[model samples]
Target: MARYKNALTKYYVGDLEEKEANLRLAKWIQAVEDDTDEEVEEEAYYDGDGTPEEDVISVKKKYSFEGFYDNDDPAHRFIADLEFEVGEDRKIWFKQERTSGEILEGPATVTEPKVTGGEASEYQHFSFAIAWDRKPDISKSDDDAGGGVEG
Candidate 1:
């Protein structure tokens, strides 16, 4: 079960690599190194109710992948990073990256994007579950000058 930390992790800033975005996270952000190859530690700010406030605007996560193209590419582009958008309100997209070339062969296609600017990417990711929200009662707030019998 994924924990909705009420805010984005300091590990992400729009779409930036961990190294490129660490500075952007600032003190409010939190991060840690994991013994495993996979990223282990991540931090996010919180509001009074354990939710991200206006000061916290991002709802995204960035993941990285680096391995040989294995397929055939001689240079063997590195799968730099994968970015994931927080929340399930919309479709999530991952940006593909290559450490050596602007475009590299992926699986059977060569359409994946490469690392550029500071745009973190998402080649792999999962969406946040959307839960039902409670409805508000506004009948009393409605202004009804006319009675049940209207001309």
Candidate 2:
């Protein structure tokens, strides 16, 4: 038997611990995208220059979450909360699933929401971007924090 990625699955974003805050929101999410890039600077060494040295200056990561916007859904409240605290730096993790162990987490600020779709077939969607400053701390599990308790 083998496992493969499926379209039906949704990604999650929440605190460091596997909290239920965003767990329920994951169900209403329709799409997820992660963008990462490095800022590099090229330096010329006059002492012994063969090829210009390229040094990584910094890294940037942006996470985008898109979902249907239904005021009736409880997830809508989560959106309001995020919007209300736009400039605040909140610890957030991007996980494939609520139960999945592997995750990328860091301090991020929520951006303004973007809405689309006002047609009969298309869905009314709400999209937002979370901008992170530091490199993500990837964790396999809460127990990945070195070792303490046995389970």
TM-score each candidate: 0.16, 0.61
Clash pairs of candidate 1? 6-52, 15-119, 15-120, 16-120, 82-121, 83-121, 83-122, 94-122, 95-121, 95-122
- Residues 46-149, model 1: lDDT tens digits: 53555543343332232332221222221221222222223332222222222211221111111233333332562222121111121111122132232222
Worst 10 residues of 2 by lDDT: 142-151
Q: Candidate 1 lDDT (Cα, whole model)? A: 0.23
Per-residue error (Å), model 1, residue 35: 17
For TM-score, the strongest prediction is 2
Q: How far in Å is the alpha carbon of 61 misplaced in model 2?
A: 1.6
Model number with the top lDDT: 2
> Per-residue lDDT tens digits of candidate 2, residues 1-151?
3333434334455664453236444545677677666899988887866678999988787767787776666555555456555344344444443234455555555576655556788887788876665665665766433223233
Off by over 4 Å in 2: 1-3, 6-10, 14-25, 46-49, 89-101, 115-117, 142-151
